[model samples]
Target: MFRGLGPEIEHRGEIVVIGLGRFGSSLSRTLVDMGHEVMGVDLDSANVQAHAGVLTHVAEADTTNEQVLRQLGVAEATTVAVCIGADIEASVLTAVALSDLGVPNIWAKAMTEPHGRILSRVGAHNVVFPEAEMGQRVAHLITGGVLEYVALDEDFVLAEMTAPASLVGVPLGESNLRRDHRVTIVCHKPDSGRFTHTDRDTVLSPQDLIVIAGRRKDVDSFGPSRR
Candidate 1:
């Protein structure tokens, strides 16, 4: 339940998303699903109303106006995401407006390096090039998403990885990894980053981020090098 789509409303640690475009709309919905109360605003009335149930607050306002921002309780929000696409000026203005409102954490979407720099100057706490960042992460595991990455320590290391096709149908104990490969399957993550190493009955999914521990070299060679 929310009131006053206008700016001067009071707020707690709510997440406010500006610009109900494709990416922004999706993120707003996801935050709602995660049990967070989200406030989504856009210049278009249709866009704001379309995502009514998914957000705790929805408004159609001209984000460039400081009064509009003030009424939305931007100063009280814990975080704000500015997602205006194609309009670099609008994005920067909104970022400045939110920061000026005293919102501590401001996240702005950048279309280019220059846009990111401008966002920084305007006081956005974080600037994200969503597509570029995701592309770089995806490129890390081009070979069918086997192991994500490995962290090495003195005697043991933590391997943040996913199950290779080689281990898809294989059970944890059957690997004989501790004896042969000298590695231990520390944890298994499944669907949505929720994990349970004790649930041995649960089959492994390609989506899992299994945490394995062992000597650095052994962890690499112990399993198939590439998925």
Candidate 2:
């Protein structure tokens, strides 16, 4: 039976990853690095061999078959990600199998909107477009002076950038950043220190790193060139 079908997927749990292609492989590796137990399944023997030493358990199996997935212990998994690439048919089928097995917290990768819709309908709790998201992230980094950019949603973003000249030497409370720029500095880190929560009294140094959260346009405009 499906269990713990919560709104959010916990990072620490037993996860079954189908497909050992680039996306699947990378995901499995990261999960293992995070100290999670991972069972990686792939149809390709080469892929299975490549990750045999890394994953807690890896097998070459036809994940499109419900019995095969169940035999691989996918049915009992708390979380599973269908990361099959290119072969949309296989991806959908694998997702269907996972759903039939009643595994909770199914995550899937979709290459297109239609494919994503199908995955969602077939019981994928979350469908992600990795390529499209990455392209958007890279575009933001190339355009703005931000050292890092994360789009929390379509409109809101969190950006990390160096403290501009205008912000240096001024306590955040005295600056009209929120009213004028419509962005809030979440935290700041000095050249030699770790990041810490920011407050109204927090003053910025010329080399301090600041993470700001706001609307995308506002965050992009709050860069070093902004006055």
lDDT of each: 0.74, 0.86
Off by over 4 Å in 2: 1-6, 9-13, 224-227
Per model, state how many residue pairs clash: 6, 0
Q: In lDDT terms, which candidate is top?
A: 2
Across 30-135, the per-residue lDDT of candidate 1 in tens digits comes to 9889888999999989999898877999999999888988987877787788999988889999988887888877788888878888888888877777765555
lDDT of 2: 0.86
Give me the displacement of residue 116 in model 1, in angstroms. 1.6
Model 1 gets an lDDT of 0.74
Give residue 144's error in model 1 in angstroms: 2.5
TM-score of each: 0.63, 0.90
lDDT of 2 by residue, 1-227 (tens): 01112378664467888889999999999999988889899899999999998999989999899998877778888889999999999999999988899877899998987898888898888888888778777887787677888877668889888898888998999999999999999999998999999998999998899999999889877774553
> Who wins the TM-score comparison?
2
**Model 1, runs deviating above 4 Å:** 1-12, 140-142, 145-227
